[model samples]
Target: MKTDNSNIDDLREVLHWIRNLVTGRLKIHFSQIDDYLVENIAFSEETTGLASFAITHQPTFIEFAVLALSYVPHIQPDFFNKIIAEYLPDGGDFPEFGCVKGTNHRGILPTGETAQFIIAGDDIGKRIAVQRLFSSEHWFAKEHVLWLEQVREGEPAMSGRMIMNPEIVELLTLGTVSKPSFSIDFPAEHIETEMDWDDLVLPETTFRQIQEIEQWIACNETLINDWGMKKRIKPGYRALFYGPPGTGKTLTAMLLGKQTGNEVFRIDLSRVISKYIGETEKNLARLFDKAENKNWILFFDEADALFGKRTDIRDAHDKYANQEVAYLLQRVENYNGLVILASNQRSNIDNAFSRRFQNIIPFPMPRPEERLSIWKKTIPQQLPLDMDLDIENIALRYELSGAAILNIIQYCSIQLLADTAPFLTAEMLDAAVRREYIKEGRIT
Candidate 1:
C-alpha cells in the first residue's frame, strides 16, 4: 500500500478546515447549503469555498504500510500496545490488511513503500465514521489550525470510490486541502423559486401516492446513479395519474416537483404537435433534452392531446400524428428523470405508451368522506361563521370538485362581506355553487 504524499497533505488540510467550521473559529460557506449558512459564514468577494467531491481509493501494499506506520504512532499508547504486543505476536489482530504483494502475496505492502494507510471497517457505520473523522476535526490537532481557514473552490474535498478486492468492493472515501476559490461569473439566467403546488385538495390515497414518490427518491438513489452513468438510455420514472378534469391531476404533478426538488415543466402538446414532417419529433427531442439536463419533471397535463389514439394513415395528417406518437415512445423510453402524464381520459392513451409506465395510479374523484375532509380543511380560520350556515349540507348537495368548492367558498365570502352577518346563508352558498356550475358550462 503506497499513499500519495499530495493526497496525504490534502487530507490533513481538510481535517483542519473542518475543525474550524465546527468551532466557529473559521467561516465556511457551502454553496449547497447556502440557504442556512449564509448568515454565519464570511468570505470576501474574491474568495468562495471549494466544491466538495468524494472518491474512494484502494491502498496498494506500499500505501498501506505508510498509513500503519504514520497513524499507529499517533494512536493512544494503551490502545496501540494492547494490539501490537498481543495481536502482532504472530503478526497482529487478524494481521492488519494492506500487506499483500502485487505479484508476491506476502508482507504489509504489495510494493511495500510503507507510506500508504489502510483504513478497514467491518460495517458501513465504521466506514462512514472514518470518512467523517477526516471530513471534520478529530484528525487535526487544534494548535496546528488557524482562524478563518476556508475550503478552496473547485477543489474536491471528498471522494467516494469502491475498493476492489476479489469478492467485494469496499467503499473508501477521502478529501483534499485547499483555499476557497471565487466564481468568475454570476449566472445570467436564474430559476424562479416562486413555483408552488396548486391549491387542489387531495384524497388520502392520492396523498399517499405522492408520499411514495418521495420515499422512492430516497431509496432509489443508487438506481438513479446507475441510470445517470448509462448513456443514450433516458432513465425517467413514469407515473399515470388518471382522473376527471378539475380533479387535481395537474396540481398533483406540480406537487411532485415542489416536494422532490425538481422543476415541473408542463409539456404543451398544442405547441409540440405540428403539421410539418418530422417537426413534432423534433419538438419532442428538444423538450426531453432540456428536461433531462435540468433534472425536471416533464409533465404532460391533458395527456390525451399527445398520447391520444394513433390514427391509421387516412392521409398525410394521420400518418404524421402516428409518427408523433412513435417519437414520444422513443423519447420517453430514454428519459432518465420523472415524466408524469395526467389525463382526464386515460382510455384515450394508446396501449403502446401505456406499457412503459411503472406506476399507474388512478386519481379518482373525491369520495364523500374525502370531500367532507376537503370542505373542512378548505374553510378559512378567520372567516366568521353564522351558526345557521350549514356547510355540511352544502358539501353534500354540490359534490363539487375541490377547486370548484374552494371557489364557491370564496365567492360566498365576498358576497356576504357587506352584510351585517359574517356567516354565509344557505341561499348565498347555493347561489355561489350555481355560478360555478354555469361557469363550467354544466348549465346554460
Candidate 2:
C-alpha cells in the first residue's frame, strides 16, 4: 500500500518521457531530479488505484509530501538517493544549508528549494511547491517545513502547492484543469444527534428547515457518495440558506455544523471574489477543491454578493456578472460537501440556479408568542428574575425579534449588575426595551 521509489520505476520512466518532451520546447531546464519526478510510477500508475487511498488516507498530497520530504532527510533509504541521483548525478549532494534560497545546489529553477523538489511526488505536492516558489520574498527552509506541516495535518495540497505567482507552478496546480469535474451520486446519510433544536431561539420554520436540511443531507447520501466518487473527491456537500437577516440564519448554520460534527468555514467573500474577469471563478474553484479535500463545510455568510441574480447585459460589466452567476451555478450544483449560502432577500437570488439547492430554509420573523418565549429564555435562570415580570405583555409591547430580545435581556442584566439589586426590575426592563428599539431601528 505504501510506495517509495523502489516500486515507481514505471512512474520514473513516465516522468522521464514527459519531462524530456516538455523541456525540449519550453526551455525550462529540468535536472534529473525533475526528470525523476515525471518518472515517479508510484503515484502515476498507482494514482488510479490509489485514487481512493490518496483521498481517504492522505487528504492533502502537498501536506503528505511536506511530511514525506521532511522525513526524507532523515530517511536512510535508497529511495531518496535514487530520486536525487536522477538529478544531481555528478556526486554533489543538495546543500542542506539552513536556508532554501541561498543554496549552492540548483535542484530547481533559480533556487534549490525543497518545495520544488517535493512536487515530484504528486499533483498535490506540485501545487504547494509552486505556491512557495513565488509567494515568498525569499524562500526559507522554514516555509518548506510549514508546507510539510500543512500536509501532515491533512490540509489540502492546492493551498500548499499553488505558488503566489500563478505563473511557474500554474500548470499542474491552481489554474483550472481541463478535466470536466465528475459528478458522483451517493445516498444521503441523515444521522441526527440528540440536539435540543428547541434550545436555539430561531424561528420554528427555520428550525424545521434545519431539520429538513439534515434529512436532505442524510437521504441524499447516495447522490453525495456518487458525486464524490465521480469527481474523485473524498466527501463534500453544498446547500443554500436564504432568509431575512436577524432570523438566526448564521446561528442555525453553526448549529448545523455542530450537528454534522464538521468544522464550518465561513467564507469572506471580499477575500474570495476577485475583480479580474474569470478570476473569481478560478478562486472559487480553488477554494471548493481545497474544502472538498479537507472536509470542511463552507459557509457563505453574505450569499447574495456571490450568488446574486444575473443582471441584464447593459455593458461588458453586465456580461461578466452573468458569467459569474453561471460559473457559480456550475460549482454549487456539483459541490458534494455541505455548502450553505445565507441571504436576506431570496428574490435577489437567480431562480434558475436556486432550484438546484436541495434544502432551502426560510427564516420568518417570530410571532408574539414566539417572542414571549424568546424573552423567557433570554433571561437566564441564574440571572436575578422578577417573577412578576409580565413577559407576555412585554413581548406584545416590544414586538421584538429574537435578536432584539437578547439585546434587551443583556441590557437588563448589565443594569441589574450595575445596581446593588440582585433582581431584574420593571424599570430596568423598560430601559432595555427603549435601548433595543433604538438599536434595532424599530422607531425609525
Per-candidate total of colliding backbone pairs? 44, 50
Model 1, range 162-198, lDDT digits (tens) per residue?
Answer: 1112111110112222211212111011122343544
TM-score of 2: 0.59
lDDT of 2 by residue, 1-444 (tens): 324443244334434443343333222234333342233224443433233234444434444343333322222224344454555578564443111321343332211234443443235566455555333352323222222222336644332322222121221222222222222211112222343556567665566767876775565566556555545543345567766556677677667767766666667677667788988877777666544433346678877887888777989888987888888777776666678888887787778757777667777777887887777777787787677877788878766666767777777777777885779777778877887777767764
lDDT of 1 at 317: 84
Model 1 deviation from the true structure expressed as Cα RMSD, one decimal place: 19.0
Q: Which residue runs does candidate 2 get wrong by more than 4 Å?
A: 1-196, 202-205, 222-238, 420-422
lDDT of 2: 0.55
Positional deviation of residue 66's Cα in model 2 after best superposition, in angstroms: 13
Candidate 1 wrongly placed segments (more than 4 Å): 1-201, 224-234, 418-422
- Model 2 C-alpha RMSD vs. true structure (Å) is 12.6
Best by TM-score: 2
Please give me the total number of clashing residue pairs in predicted model 1. Answer: 44
